[model samples]
Target: MQKHIFNIHDVVLFMTVAECFLLVIFQAILPVKNQLANRLLSTFLISIAITSACILVLWNDDVSLFTAFDEYLLPYFLVIAQMLKGPLLLIYVIALTEDAFKLARRHLVHLIPAAVAVAWLALFQIDSTDLRFRTLGMTETERQIANGVWHFIKIMPFFYALAAVNRVRLYRIGLHNQYSNFSPTEPSWLNILTLGFLFTWSFSILVHVIANTVALAAPQISDLFGIAENYIIFILINALFVNSVVHTHKLLTTKPEAAKDKVDEKLTDTAIQKVQQGMEIQKLFLKQNLNIDEFSKRINLPVKEVSAVINKHYGTNFFEFMNSYRVEEAKRLLSDNQHADMTVMDVLLHAGFNSKSAFHRFFNRLVGMSPTEYRKQNMNKEVKIA
Candidate 1:
């Protein structure tokens, strides 16, 4: 029996995997209200950890460890891990962005490719002993297949990453459109995380492309390329883990103060009614760049008292409360046939939104579509009615 040798690479990869595993475990044990989102994030972390482990094993070049496991199992596991990257990322993004996100039966469709890859590998293991041996030993043909599959895997995540970025983008937009002080509502960590994934994934793909092209001319350099690729993967994994830990810690540890008690103490029913009447009857929300202090002054209530009334009765901060009204007015203007000639910008400005991006974002959040789409749909409906 050959004793397994440990190297610096092995130590680093093990640490990376350990970090990811710890993150998943911590997230699972934490009694968060959004368990579904936490679970999806954990799943994403675990998938990456599994992929890192497989890469480390492959890099170690120790066949002795395979004695414990079936010959085909490792290769199948690696392929499945690669297949899962795209789907898991997409689902995780949805979990974060969608308030009512739940794993539906249709979501299983994303896992079909991984299931199919496992089935194909299983059949390969049974049908051809020579091919099984080739796969386990990483023969030239097997390596070529792997290279092709990796290219496909890299491409697959591009779409998912695009979707995730778009989701975050819209979420940010919604916040700005619905809140005067939207800075507090920003998910800076999530934005950073999504961008990091994109950058690392793209970097890996570029490295692979360059390595493969170079290998064609200098076949002997393939082993060196493989070593470099393994190191890059390890670094990428470590970077992502570190980034996640820092951001996640900030997210979990820093709890915003609930305004319930303040609202209960300072705000009266009569005051709440006065503020509501002022907002609705006077259309105070149409005042551009309105703040809590300004609104409070207008309603002749203390700032904290006004803020509490909005927070308690409206279930949103003063910023959000004001922006909701602006968004509603924007919607009405956009849908009206009289404003058919008006561009989105014109309507957004008229609706008291200084930022075009905020207008589009908030409109999409409230309507589940873009301002352009909403206008088009409404116009089409009117045309048909006529």
Candidate 2:
């Protein structure tokens, strides 16, 4: 019975790792710009890899090499996984703080301890008997050392949960003031699902730690713990992936009728004058590379009104609207003779674009063709004219 139980748990563990790995691959391959989503997926992948590797090394007897990998590697891996939890939460917060993410170089220093721990493990060449690692069948002290490290790592998830809760609150408050209508910019379902996932993982980790610490009656109980943890992680990952896929599909197929309605409703005679004046003011500042607030002030419209008008009428925000004009000007500059020798990049910057990638993104989005392709087409037209 015990052998069959272990086999079942092993299958679940391997399947969990495979599913999570596919999720990581999906995130890497997909054009997901949500930094929170990216960080969560990445953290899960790294943690799952390290955990699965340690589990196989500790439990698998099919390969002698894995069995001989030493218990020291387990604690080290667990500590690193623990250290990543806090930062992953912070990354989620930073990602959602604003649409334009600015992750500071200094914040990366958070990984210093994890790096040092790994370096210590490698440099000292610590044996399995060291305080960091010991087998479960060893002395009570050794068992404690093994179990304690896992428990310590499990506590880090609470830090992540706290950060997530605070972020959700802030998100709700920000949306309440920012949007004029339903304020559905903050998706309630997503918020609830994210919170539910964070807590589910947190509780599972805590329970696993507690179960191991107490030394339950049957070692098979650990199998139960493993199965539960595996299922929760698997479900959470798949839920997020499915949500992203479905949301994207709907966004592509259903052209945001609510936003369209908002646009149509606001394009009245009085609103059209406001939008026209806003656009004209916007054009004047395009050459100067002005920001949203500056354009809002110049047009004498509230920032929310400005944002709404641009988002609705132009089907883009202030930067995008401004960039469309700049890109058009850049194309004209590229086609003119005085600057004929200048590169496309040179003309892009001279026309107020900040970066090459930004220029390409906006150009492709607005022009429906790559900058190089557009340039080639225009050049051929000039050739025909000559």
Which stretches of model 1 miss by more than 4 angstroms?
1-4, 68-70, 123-146, 184-186, 216-386
Best by lDDT: 1
Question: Can you tell me which runs of candidate 2 are displaced by over 4 Å?
Answer: 1-6, 33-40, 60-74, 112-145, 182-186, 216-222, 248-386
- Scanning candidate 2 in windows of ten residues, the lowest lDDT window is 248-257
- Residues 1-386, candidate 1, lDDT per residue (tens digit)? 97757776577667767877987877777766667767777877787777777766654555225543434456666667777877887777666555466898999888887776666566545222232333465677666554555566556666677677777776664443334634332377677667767766766676667666785687556655555555665665565555444544333211122345656666678888888887889888888877655677777876657766766677676656777888899889989998889988888888888877777777888889998888889889999999
lDDT, candidate 1, equals 0.67
Local distance difference test, candidate 2: 0.59
lDDT of each: 0.67, 0.59
Candidate 1 residue pairs in clash (backbone atoms < 3 Å): none
